[model samples]
Target: MDKFTTLTGVAAPMPLVNIDTDMIIPKQFLKTIKRSGLGKNLFDELRYEADGTEKPEFVLNQPAYRNAEIIIAGDNFGCGSSREHAPWALLDFGVRCVISTSFADIFYNNCFKNGILPIALPQDVVDTLMEDAGRGSNARLTIDLEGMKVVTSDGTEFPFELDPFRRHCLLNGLDDIGLTMEKADSIRGFEEQMATARPWI
Candidate 1:
């Protein structure tokens, strides 16, 4: 996991609500447990046609948003199935943050575990950011996690709330495994003590 302190980059506007996990990476691409190679297929159905050609009308297909590092989406973002691949696909596609009015519980947690920040802001605030993101590549949004605020290109700032523990984990680049590793010394000490006490066994 990568430490997420502050991120400044292009933000693509996706106003569609109820964006389920399947729509993110599609079920066909879920055969592999690996997180890499899924970026190319992120939003596959929306990005391509039946012939597998690029869809020009899609927001991600646009030149300006092709390399967007953040996504400002509609309400109920990351709804439906609880597949962890959704966040993996998003992170692999260079999307380090996602801002929306609301998000599904499972997907929101998964985002943090995968080093992607999923922010839930009020609808009005999201609308403003969405408009800001419409400025193509010219506008770049900055998210300061330590400061707990999102700054627009024009200097407007919106504060968001996040769990303190999650913030700590992201700041230190600690995943579940990383958290466990933090207690390695204590674990080893405990094991040694147990061996001495149970020598006969």
Candidate 2:
């Protein structure tokens, strides 16, 4: 996981709602446990035709959105299965943040764990951001994680809420494993004491 202090980059507008985990990375691509290389398959069905060629009509295939780092999507984003691979694919695709009117609980949490910021704002706020993202190359949005705010290219700013602990973890690049490693000394001490107390085992 990478630290997500601040990010300023292109934002792609995805107005479709109910973008499930499978859509983020189709079921066929879920066979592997590795997180890398899934980006190529992100939105596989929508990004490619049956022949496996890039779909020119897809938002991601457009030249301006090819490198989009932020996504402004419609309501009910990330709804459906609880596969953690969704966030992995998005992160691998260089999407550091996703702004939507709402998101499925499991997917929202997964995004935080994977170093991707899933922001749930009011519908009006999301609509504004979505419009801002329609500007193609000029859709530069700034995500200030520490500041808990998103700034549009035109200088409009909107504050968002986040759990303090999740905020802390992202700022320090701490995932579940990283959180455990933070108490390495304590864990080692506990193990040593257990061994000494139960010598037979």
Best by lDDT: 1
Q: What would the TM-score be for candidate 2 when compared with the true structure?
A: 0.97
- Superposed by TM-score, candidate 1 places the C-alpha of residue 42 at a distance from the truth, in angstroms, of 0.4
Which lDDT tens digits does candidate 1 get at residues 25-142? 8999999999898999999999999999999999999999999999999999999999999999999999999999999999999998999999999999999999999999999999
Per-residue lDDT of 1-201 in model 2, one digit per residue for the tens?
A: 799999999999999999888899889998999989999999999999999999999999999999999999988889899999999999999999999989999999999899998999999999999889999987699999989999999999999999999999999999999999999999999999999999888
Candidate 2: residue pairs that collide: none
Residue pairs with clashing backbones, model 1:
none
Best-matching candidate per TM-score: 1
Models 1 onward score TM values of 0.98, 0.97
| Cα error, candidate 2, residue 123 (Å) | 0.7
- Candidate 1 local Cα displacement, residue 61, angstroms: 1.0
RMSD of each: 0.8, 0.9
